[model samples]
Target chain A: MTKEELKIKIEDILPAATFDETGEWLNILIEAKAWYGFAKQIRSSRELEFDYLFCLTCIDWKTHLTMVYHFTSTYRRHTIVIKSKLDRNNPEIESVAAIWRTAEFHEREVYELFGVKFLNHPDMRKLLLTDDWSGGFPLRKDFEDPINMIRL
Target chain B: MIEEVGTTTEGDLIINIGPQHPSTHGVLHLVITLNGETIKNVEPHLGYIHRSIEKMCESLTYRQFIYVTSRMDYLSAHINNHGCALCVEKGLQIEVPPRAQVIRVLMDELTRLASHQLWWGAMGMDVGALTPFFHAFREREMINEIMEETCGARLTMNYMVPGGVMFDLHPNFQHRVKKFIEFFKSKIDEYHELLTGNMIFVNRMKGVGFLSKEDAISYGCTGPTARGSGVICDIRKLYPYEVYSQISFEEVIETGGDCLSRYLVRMEEMRQSLSIIEQLIDNIPEGDFQAKTKAVLKLPKGEFYSRVETARGEFGVYIISEGGTTPYRIKFRSPGFSNLSALNHMAKRSKIGDLIAIMGTLDLVIPDIDR
Candidate 1:
């Protein structure tokens, strides 16, 4: 199925979700409260299995954080992009690591780098960063490290 | 003396297999808890070669970041470059010309063949078969030469650009590729004669490191590692990219899920990749080599995810753009991460000697894992 068809199908299921057609895959922006339920439905729905949670990551957008989940159904050969806006101060969400096993490490990575908490994650430890990393959320737009400087 | 000899209790022997050892391959330290000859547990300690490629990509322009990915999986550098280029193209909404797509496919297949050749040699050496190492390297050298002639550097050839390739196919590309294929075909019989049918090699690998299909999928193993367990999860076949849709090839699958099965699958995959290159070499398409795009690329404020089938398995590059030349965020979903996850599951019931063979068959390149 094309990105347009996937978008329409997702919108039909969850009316409140917003979408951006500019990116490569179909990007559907969902409210934080609706994310968990929509994810479960998407997984169990026969029309869209989305069995593979290939990539799950978080982007810190200065003002707020955006949680991105890249889903693909091996059976249906379709791709969907799910995003949820999170409060920049204390981002938290229910972990989907239980549903798709591949999300275990990815969720932990998001938790560490963006300071987003995966509520039920089995093991949420620092993945790529060190224990003494004092730089707050390195990927955020506002982050600055004088130790690691750059030339303009 | 009698008490010491007869009344002794057996304790597990702990052995550090790497972080510097030759067989561990690239700064990987495997702490093996052994009960005599049997392995009780194998714990992998990583992060030695972590250069923070993802973190580095945030600072580089979209064009410059492709070179950084080349360093991740150094063996299949062309495939890595192809993947990053494809993601950038997707992000920028650029359409590559048909000829460029075909050339990309050709380079990808050659990279696959070269990677499998190195795997074959290294795997054989891991299982105490040394001669196949030279044989494998002999064939791999041809591929390296071909890559160097076109892309300049052998291992980390950043040949792929966003709109198209760095350059068109070399004038002698077709001729050299055809020669390599014929040469590889003639050497296939020698591979079988020397190693595949050898009695000693079979005994060492057969029935070792068995992973059931259910465990393989649940753990998210991919590439030949998962295919060895009868899982048909080839990203090239399932999610056709570039010119893979145009060509026909078999996804080699074996049900044994042992060291021998993994070995045979990689061998068969090498043959299939050669077949693909043979089919693509003669029919060079005539068109523009690259797509037209702006000098400075500005991706719309959003997220883009691209999954390409690497030599390992499903390799994903997720890019988040915030209307800037440099990506706001980039994440690499490496195949080795999942493949490495299955190691403890596969090695729990195996012997110490079999651990090397198991690790070999998984084909875990440490930099890719640490990245």
Candidate 2:
């Protein structure tokens, strides 16, 4: 489907959705509270079976955190991006691990680096960091590693 | 301190496979729960080599960060840099010249061939045959010499920049690549004779660590690993970057999801890579290699992502730029991380020796996973 058709289809499902088509793929911005249902529709809708969760990450914007997901359909051969903004103080979102298994690892990585908790995630522990680490989320803009003196 | 498996009896054994095991190909720690040579679970402990590359890239400029990715998957360093360069170019809206695109495709295919050669050798060695390692490197050295002569680095050649390549091809780039392709074509037959038809190697690999098509997709497997299970996840075909759209090559697929299927998929992939290189090497157009760009690049405030089919799988570069010379946030979707995530699923109920066969076909490079 064309990007314009995708925008219309998504608008029908969630009228509050906004799109940014400046980049190559179509980016849909949705509310954090509505993400779980919206993601399920995106996967189950016959026209848009985004079966592959190719990339999942978090962007720390100081005031808030944005969770980004890139998906592609092997059958339809179309790609789309989904973004949801979360409160920076304590970010939490529903986990899609049950829907797409790839989200299990990607969510764990984001959990350790950005401190975004994935609700309902089976095994929620540090996947790439030592268990004893007590520093704040390193990917956050305000994170300061006094021991390493690493700040951006 | 270990968590017991479900309904465990008195004699269940849990073993540590190596944060420094030689067969792992890198520093990958696998905690295996064994019930007398049958694996119940295989959990991978990463971060031993986690350099926090995403955190580090926030501090480097657009041009400087490309080299950091070279260390992620050192085996497919060229493809890793290419993905980052493509993302930067996409953000800045720079159109690379046609000549540079062709050269990039050529280099990428050569890199794939080199990576497969190493995997083929190491896979044999992992299965207890040592001679294939020497034979595999003998062919790989030719490709490395060709890369060194042109890109000026052996493994981590930071040859790609935002707009185009770092430098134009060397004077003998075409000659050397052609020679290497011809030499490799002849050696491929020898490779098949030495390992592919060997009864012991076939017996060890076939029907070991079977991952069905549905499972491969659910686990996010890509490249030959996914293709071995009859899933068409080849990024070159799915989302063509560079001149790949114009090239004609088959996405090698096998119905058998065993280690042998994965092994044959990679073996056929090497042949396909040779064909791709042969098609592009002769027709490299003569034009400006690098497009002219500003002294400093500042991407508009937006998100840009690009993916390349690396030797192991699909490697993606996602950049969030806030109209600055440096990215506000950068995330590398390395294939090893997702591929490694499926090790537990693949290794379950397999013997201790079969784990080596499974990992060998997976062809993991742990730095990529940790990064």
| Best candidate, DockQ | 2
Clashes of each: 0, 0
TM-score of each: 0.88, 0.96
**Please, what are the lDDT tens digits per residue for candidate 1 over residues B152-236?**
8889888888988888888988899999998999787788789989998999899999998866766678899999999888988
- CAPRI grade, predicted model 2: medium
Give the C-alpha miss distance for residue B248 in model 1, angstroms. Answer: 2.0
lDDT per residue for candidate 2 within A1-152, as digits (tens), equals: 99999899999989999999987889999988898899899889999988889899999888889999999888898889999999988899999998888889999999999999999998898888887888878888888777664444
Give me the runs in candidate 1 sitting further than 4 Å from their true place. A1-47, A131-136, A145-152, B1-15, B32-41
Worst 10 residues of 2 chain B by lDDT: B1-10
Model 1 chain A: worst 10 consecutive residues (lDDT sum) = A143-152
| Top model number, lDDT | 2
RMSD of each: 4.7, 2.0
lDDT tens per residue, model 2, B216-282: 8878899888889999988898789999999999999999999999999999999999999999988
